[model samples]
Target: MENFTPSISVSSQVTHSLLARLLALAYVDQEVDLREVELIYGIALERGVSKETLESIMLRPHSVSTILPSTPHERVSHLYDLARLILADGIIKEEERAMLRRSVLLYEFTEENADGIVDFLLEQAQAGVAPAQVIQVVQESI
Candidate 1:
């Protein structure tokens, strides 16, 4: 897969929502791992989100609206990022998998494709594929 740079600009709501979801996933095991925090922080930084804003969301994820991105690329990008966060701690908890499945529906992927997409994303993340490459592969298949 070639390099992919998502050109879409998402609202602050979307970014916060994604971060909030990441936070939720990180705590699925009942403890927040350092790796998970680092991954989420890195993602936030890459998207130009402020540390203060991320800290605020960390303090209160409920304040962030669950706004999904409008475009397929943006949706897949967010999903891939979530997949990466799931694999950050080198463990795949049942709760984390459940969250990814729920996210597929929230992202508007058809039910028929949701399981396969989630499986593929997890496989790619486990194999250590870059998020951009994983997003590109999924987009091409779509």
Candidate 2:
């Protein structure tokens, strides 16, 4: 059988869920940095999430249940971006780590491998690795 890849549609639910998870992570440290907010807003805007919806979700991200991406690539992509957000404010607090675990569970990533995945992403991000490379390595690892 020929390998087939179905394109993942960027729906408003996906965008909102992605941002909500990121926003929840951002708030984990108890200090939402402007840079982090900017990144989330930028992504939300690009993904066609309404400003109003983004604001609402941003205000109460904990209330939003993240809609996990269905594909491997989508999962890795979201995890990569979450890693970026973790490093955005120049701090990765313990609180953020806890939040990432919740996100991993929410995304249905293997519980045992969740820490390893976050650690990998943090190492790559700290080394200034390209996003594409990070995703590629993550995909390979998975």
Q: Which predicted model would earn the best TM-score?
A: 1
Instruction: Judging by lDDT against the true structure, name the best candidate.
Output: 1
Clashes of each: 0, 0
- Residue-by-residue lDDT tens digits, candidate 1, 1-142: 9889664355877888899998988888899898999999999998889999899999998877788888899888899889999999888889899899999998998999889989988998999998788777767877
lDDT of 1: 0.88
Which residue pairs come into collision in candidate 2? Answer: none
TM, every model: 0.89, 0.78
Model 2: what TM-score?
Answer: 0.78
Give Cα distance to truth, residue 59, candidate 1, Å: 1.0
Model 2: lDDT of residue 140: 83
- 102 in model 2: Cα distance from truth in Å? 2.2
The alpha-carbon lDDT assigned to residue 71 of candidate 1 equals 86
- lDDT (0-100) at residue 93 of candidate 1? 87
**lDDT digits (tens) for residues 1-142 of candidate 2:** 9888774455556767888888877777788799998878876776677789889886777776657777877777777778778878777788876777677767787889888877877777667677778777767876
Off by over 4 Å in 1: 1-10
CA RMSD (A), model 2? 7.7
